[model samples]
Target: MEPLLTAHNNEATSIAQLTAAQQKLYQWDKTIAAKHLYLIENKDTPYERLTTLKKHLAPLDATRQRDLIARYKALQTPPRGRRVEEWLRSWVEITNMCIAADVPETMGSRAQEDFLVACRTINPEYGTSGLRDLIDLEDAGTAIPSVEDYVSKFTTYLKRVLPLSTGLSSMAAELDVSKPQQQNKDGNKNGNKTKPQCPCGLKHY
Candidate 1:
C-alpha cells in the first residue's frame, strides 16, 4: 500500500487544511505505520517490551486506537467467501477506508457495488439472491434512504434469512448422504426424510 501520508501530502496544500475527519484518519494511519516501523527496527525485541512506544507518537484515545487497529487488519485481508456476514463486513471495511481517505463519494459507492457484484458472479445461485433482495427492498420504499441505511437494512435482512438459506441446507444434505439410507417396507430408501421442505418455498431446502 502506498503510504496514506504521502498521498495526502501530494493532494493537499497543507496538513492544517484537512477537515477534522481527514486529520483524525491521517493520525491513525501515521500511528499504525509508526508502530510497525518501530517493531521492524527493534527486530530482536518483543512488542511487550516496547515500553516507550506510545511516547514516540501522537496520543490517541484507547477505544479509537482499538477501532483503527481492527479496521486496519480488515483492510490487510482480501475479502473472501460468498457468506453474507463475511462479505458485508468486507464491503463495509472498503467503504470506511475510502471515507477515511476522503476519496470521492462516487468512487466509494462504485467500489462497494463492484464488490457485491463480484460476490454474485462467483456464486450466482446463492450470492445473486442477496444483491437482488437489496435492490427489491430499496425499490419498495424501504428504510434505505441513504447508502448507510442501505447497508444497515441489507445486513439485517441477510441475518434474518441466513438460517433458511440454501447454503446451510446443502450442508445438511451432504451430512445426510454420508449415513446409511434406511430401507422402507417395499425396499425403497426413505430419502424423503433427508431433505426437509423449506418453509419459505424459496429453494432454500
Candidate 2:
C-alpha cells in the first residue's frame, strides 16, 4: 500500500494500481456512508443497516484509511477530487445533522411496514440500492439538483408521514382491547351473581 502511495508521486510510473485502489476505497466509503444515512433515515433498520456497513468496511486495511485521508486532503480545495475520506466525512456530517434534528424512530413491525409504504408512496425509487446510490452521488458532489434539494424534499415527506405512522400505531394499541374472560358456569365464585365488566370491557370478580 505504501508502495502504491509513493507510486502517485512518481511521474514515470503509470499509477494505475494506485488509481484502482483509490476507486475501491471510494466505493467502500460511499457504502459506509450510505448505510449510516439509511440507519438515520429508517430507524427501524439501524441494527441491520449498521451491521452491513461494518461488514463492508471491516476488510479495509489501515493503509487504505491513511491513503484515503491523504487523498481527501488533496480534494478539500477547489476542483474537488474524488476521494473516499472526504465523501465519508460528508456522510458523517449529514447523519449528524439528521440526528440533531431529533428524527423519530420507526419502532415495531407494523410501524416499520407503514413507514416503508410511506417512503414508497413519497418516492417510488427509494429502496436500499436507490437510496444508497443517491447518497453516494450526493456525498461525492456529483448529484444533479444538489444534495440539499434532494434532502429538503425527503425531509418534508418524512415529517408529514412519520406523525401519521406513529398515530396509527398508537391507535392500534389502544383499539386492540382484549376480550374479557368468561367464568365457568359450573364453578360460580359468588352464589349466582354475575361479574361486572370494567370500562375496558374486562370482567372482574
Q: Model 1 Cα RMSD, Å?
A: 16.9
How high a TM-score does candidate 1 get? 0.32
Candidate 1 residues 37-120, lDDT tens each? 543343223343244455554354445555554554454333433344555565576566555654444243444354445545
lDDT comparing candidate 1 with the true structure: 0.49
- Compute the lDDT of residue 68 as modeled in candidate 2: 47
Weakest 10 consecutive residues, lDDT, candidate 2?
Answer: 103-112
C-alpha lDDT of candidate 2 relative to the true structure: 0.40
TM-score winner? 1
Model 1 misplacement above 4 A: 1-86, 102-108, 119-147, 164-205
